[model samples]
Target: MSRLARLGLAVTLLFALAAPVRAQVKDDTPRNYGVGRVATPGQIAGWDIDVRPDGRGAPPGRGSVKDGEKVYLDKCAACHGEFGESAGRWPQLAQGKGTLASHDPVKTVGSYFPYLSSVFDYIRRSMPFGDAESLSNDELYAVTAYVLNLNDIVDDKFVLSKETWSRVKMPNQGGFFDDDREKTEKAFWNSNPCMKDCREPVKITGHAQAVDVTPDEKTQKRGVE
Candidate 1:
């Protein structure tokens, strides 16, 4: 074959290869990562680990407060004291039942958490801090039951599981209200301007440096000021 024809064939082959490279260089568009294919039961079961406020995602296992107490002694008492009082810098998990609006509020699970599902989710995801996901479903339920019992929320024989999880009510459930962001945004946006006429001239009504430090005993002896 002629050299010209050979060069033309080689150029054609290079163009063919470059076509795919050009296609690959296009900008990345957004993709729906979880759109296709209905997840199998096993796959859904593996990642559906979120516990909802209504105890929607609780697993199939039962644990009583008694069982939870044993589990707490073995796995949790080192950090969260024997009765969930907290050992040192760790948080106290119990004994703060009715102090939400106090000047010094001591928030515990019984006093603060609005949902029992949140407590179970937190313990199942990250508790005992160092070890994560080390407890069985039954053990998690037991520990949660024990903690609730310690906080004087649940009865000693209360068993926690997916079926009974939603029935466990918290004390602070009615303390919070829905977000009123529309009113808040309108107030901030429509408020009057305060650039220069915000306040009156500063006045020094009192000064700690000019206070009289002399004893009042001589005034008492005189019986008059």
Candidate 2:
């Protein structure tokens, strides 16, 4: 081919490749969809509320179990029952004092939760369903005290405040342990194996049968099976 024609073909290919590069550079520009505004301190203070286990974020207030009982009856009894037994498919907040590892374990505030702060945090963040964060600090304290009283963990006259919050200990506090995978790894690696014929043959000894399989008189009268 001629030298000028070859040079023109090379220029055409270079422009075609550069067109995509230019289009990509244009598409990669920073986009701002009105979601990049900085938050003020007041805005942060309104939403940044979280309590720690060591009673770090407890608000300043107090409430006795007696006062909490009144609050529970007025505000919480409709869903949580008059005694925290749960209305329907809600949650039972009380009872289950010492039944953690049973076949039918009844896990409640008194039996399962390890920290009291979690209870307070949960109430503060979400409670009474539709009305969130409506309770005052003292009211939250009173409700927590009432729940503890209902769980049989504290006396009816016991007061719960920032000062006395950490004194209450749950029944299953010692049930949790830190993860020790290193020790577990050594134990698993050093164990002996029984790969050959380790399992024994099993036999079916008993079978389950329905006891109340009798049909009702109405079905018999209707000639329905």
Candidate 3:
């Protein structure tokens, strides 16, 4: 089996073995460390981070859009712009409100995401590039609120907390539809595919006048291309 499959099997076996004693314990979820020992509470806390779409697993805390600006400038502005327009190759986090159907769509936290939990969860675990998981709960809340304010999803006075987190609606919340292709597209599978009569013969209609992706001949020799 693959590495992931093996690890999953190990976790399942461990959970089954330790479920009886730990079933009544309710502070946090149980975990297995793969070394024939149960993971400690501290270790479980580090990895037990995952916020759902309906805000079922959010932790208790609060932050405001006003307070979030400072956190954004200090920690996030170096990579993502002050207003969430990202630098050189970094990901943009704000704006892109109505460009989802445009030719050059800019997907940002405001325009593309469907869940507020995702915004909070991402920064909580994987933000600030080099310094990941360094922000405190309030700091993460503040930065998240600031990014939302940049996109106009929330006002400056709006406070983000576990209680009000799910109330903030994203523009694309209902943009995606549930997958029903298996039932609706049964005709496609019932009939045989027309390999010979699929479409007209392919033809090249355009060519690039000046473009080169291949490295220079000299650069190739040095293996630095």
Top-TM-score candidate index: 3
- The predicted structure with the larger lDDT, 1 or 2, is 1
**For model 2, how does the per-residue alpha-carbon lDDT over 91-191 read when each residue is reduced to its tens digit?**
78888765776787877788788888878899989976789899988899999999988888888889999889778876677778999888877766755
TM-score, every prediction? 0.68, 0.65, 0.70
Q: Report the Cα lDDT for residue 84, model 1.
A: 84
The residue-by-residue lDDT of candidate 1 on 90-179, one tens digit each, is 888998766777888878888888889878999998876899888999999999999999988899889998888867888888878989
Error of 1 at 188 (Å): 2.7
Report the CA-based lDDT of candidate 1 relative to the real structure.
0.87
lDDT of 3 at 23: 56
Tell me model 2's lDDT, rounded to 2 decimals: 0.84
lDDT pick, better of 1 and 3: 1
Clashing pairs in 3: none
Error of 2 at 157 (Å): 2.7
Report the C-alpha lDDT of model 3 over 114-139, residue by residue, as the tens digit: 88887888888798778998888888
lDDT of all predictions: 0.87, 0.84, 0.84
Which clashing pairs does model 2 show? none
| Candidate 3 deviant stretches above 4 angstroms | 1-35, 40-42, 180-202, 207-225
